[model samples]
Target: MSDNLQNDNVVIESPEPVDTTLPMVIYALYLASIVTGGLTALVGVVIAYVYRGKGPEWLDQHYRYQVRTFWIGLLYFCLSGVLMFVLIGFVLWLVAVVWLVIRCVKGFKGLQEKRSPENVDTWLV
Candidate 1:
């Protein structure tokens, strides 16, 4: 009876796998950011900050990567807008578009594979 009681009291605890929704939302936000010309990324940024600490190790990388992408992309766009006066904004804008596409594609692909980006901490892709 004592052995039975001991066995009953023993608990096996295991951590749950990271939720998939965060990465999907991040990916969607990237798409929306591209479509809206960096407008909706602000909302994405907010989500990133709000849930930054709630995720586990792997998911935290996505959050950081997303936050960096939004801010850097926004800064690039703003600079490009001002450079429009010098006939250079067009080129910068094109670069921003390409950068955004690459980031989103890479992020989505990573999530699809159930892996974090190779270097989520870097500004470059």
Candidate 2:
């Protein structure tokens, strides 16, 4: 009698949890880039491009943000290298490091809040 009563009218409806692996890996790569001369950042860009549109809505921003980070950092570093003759490269190196650090920190914080970045395509944070 108790079993029938419990099963007759009860219902459970819970939404599936969000997957966080990709975001976590991207964030780690951003950090590791600072330490590993950006080899991990290159890997992060590949992951971002491959999985860009394959995740939840909120996740798209992360992929875009990460990809932007990689390409823009690459552009800055390359420009810096090319302009090394006049000592501008050192200044660019400083700017690129600060830019990357800020963007990564902001992205990680946004991920923790389960929110998308406002300006994923911006060159600077």
How many residue pairs clash (N, CA or C atoms closer than 3 angstroms) in each of the candidate models, in the order given?
Answer: 0, 0
Tens digits of lDDT, candidate 1, 1-125: 99999999998889876677866787688778777866678878888888876776667777778888888888888999999999999999899888887888888888777787667877767
lDDT of 2 by residue, 1-125 (tens): 99999999798878678786787788789778878988999898998999899877888889888888899899987898788888998898888888888888888888888888768878779
The CA-based lDDT of model 2 is what?
0.84
TM-scores for the candidates: 0.83, 0.83
The Cα local distance difference test for each model comes to: 0.81, 0.84
At residue 9, candidate 2 shows an lDDT of 75
Q: Look at candidate 1 and tell me the lDDT of residue 46.
A: 88
TM-score of 1: 0.83
